[model samples]
Structures are given as C-alpha cells and as structure tokens.
Target: MRGEELQELTLEELQHLERTLDVGLSRVIERKEQQIMERLNGLEQKGMQLLETNKKLREKVEELAEKQAVTDHPENVFNEDAHSSESGSLDCDDTSDTSLKLG
Candidate 1:
C-alpha cells in the first residue's frame, strides 16, 4: 500500500494485516520445504541406482579378468595337446613337409 493509504489504516487494521501476512509467509515456507524434501528423495534414489550400476560394472571387470587370465597363461597358450616339446627340437607331423618351396 502507498504511504498515504497505510497511514489511513487504524491500529486494529494494521494488526490484522500483520496476521494475514504471517499466515501467507508460513504457507510459502511450508511449500518450499516440501519441494526440498522431494528433491532430496530423488537424489537418494539416483545414488542407489549409481551404486547398483557400479557393482555390476565391477563384477563384469572381474569376470573379464578371469577369462583373460585363462587365455593369457603361458602353459595354456603353447600346450594344447598336454605334451611338452623337447627343448631345441621342432615338433612336427610326419605327413607334413617341413621344407619351404620357392616359386
């Protein structure tokens, strides 16, 4: 209200106006609190989802590591027939020619 209008109001009217404003301010504060609580709940749910995703990713990494370990082991790579070749000797099949042909 303008200064002239506010000056026209009696003491009782000013007290009533104060009470109305207090009620409006309380409602506004309550709505803001509710909004904050909702946002907090959303953030908590997102955090849980991220944790679950991280767990799944970790498990996948471990599984891949185990598979890689089996494939990358020296014994597994060179010993498919379960026999160790003699040192300095070439293990070859008799049916196959060992010489390289030049064209």
Candidate 2:
C-alpha cells in the first residue's frame, strides 16, 4: 500500500491485515515443504533403481566369468574320445594292409 493509504487505515484494520499476511505466509511455507518432500521421495526411488541395476550388472558379469573359466580350461577343451585319439591309443591288425601314422 502507498504511504497515504496506510495513514488512512485504523489500528484494527492494520492488525487484521497482519493476521491475513501471517496465514498466507504459513500456507506458502507448507506448500514449499510439501514440494521439497516430493522431490526427496523421487530421488530416493531413483537411487533404488540405480542400485538394482548395478546388482544385475554384477550378476551378469559373474555369469560371464564362470562361462569363460569353463571354456578357458585345457582339460575341458577335449572330450575323452578326442583325448584317446590324440594319444594314439587305437589298435591295428597285422593282417590289414593299412598302416597307421603317428604325428
């Protein structure tokens, strides 16, 4: 209000204006608090989502490592049949004209 308008108001009117301002300020503060709380809740949910994603990624990495370990082992690269053939364990008959060559 202008200075001239303030001079025209009685003491009771000024007190009423003060009370109205206080109520309005209280409502404004309450709304701001509510907004802040909502933002915090949203951030918490995002944090949980990120944590879950991180856990899943770690699990996937572990699974891949296990698979790699099995494939990388020399013993697992060849089966029993292949091992026996590679070791020249086959028997040859003397009557046969064919001869076996070992590398």
Candidate 3:
C-alpha cells in the first residue's frame, strides 16, 4: 500500500510493512555482495594477464641486454692468418717442433 494508505492503517499493519522493508533491504545487500564478487574475479583475471605481460617483457629485456653485450665487445684485431688455424694455440705450427727440438 502507499505511504498515505499505511498512515491510515492500524499499528500492526505499519509493523508488517516495516518487516517487508527490512527483508527488501537485506535482498539489496545480497545483490551488492554478488556484484562485488564478480568485479573481484575480473580484477584477478586482469592481474594474471599483467603478470604474463611482465614475464614476456622481462624476457625481451634480457634478449636486448645480451645483444647489447655482444655488440659492445671489442672488434677482432688479430690477422686472418692467426685466426684461421684449427689449433687455438697462438704460435705457428712450426713452433711446436721448435720447442720440442730445444727441449
């Protein structure tokens, strides 16, 4: 009933209206909690997406840093003849026998 109708009613009728109002208020509170839960779930999904993005970015940064390190290395100053040999030994092949002969 309308407020003016309820104002004309007995005290018991007003109390019954107040009870229904309280129940409706509780329903509104429950609906708000559901809305909040859904929003929180969405936020968690976004947080996971952000974490994945962060991981990929870190990997890209590491790749860039490695590329930078390689570029920063000093240029090879040694002659081609020096580096072409299969042996990592700095001396000429003849020098191996020379050392043996001296010994």
**Candidate maximizing TM-score:** 1
Using lDDT as the measure, what is the rank order of every candidate, best first?
Answer: 1, 2, 3
Model 1 scores what on Cα lDDT? 0.80
Point to the candidate with the largest lDDT. 1
Query: For model 1, how does the per-residue alpha-carbon lDDT over 1-103 read when each residue is reduced to its tens digit?
Result: 2235687789999999888888988999999999999999999999999999999999999999988978865433446455455565556668855665566
- Candidate 3 residue 89 Cα shift, in angstroms, is 17
lDDT of 3 at 92: 47
User: What's the lDDT for all of these models?
Assistant: 0.80, 0.79, 0.78
lDDT of 2: 0.79
Residue 103, candidate 1: C-alpha displacement in angstroms: 40
**Per-model TM against the reference:** 0.65, 0.62, 0.61
- Off by more than 4 A, model 3: 1-7, 74-103
lDDT of 3 by residue, 1-103 (tens): 3466554778898898989988988999999999999999999999999999999999999999877866764332347665756776664456333332222
Displacement of residue 26 (Cα, Å) in model 3 is 1.3
Name the lDDT value of residue 3 in candidate 2: 33
Error of 2 at 62 (Å): 0.9
Better of 1 and 2 by lDDT: 1
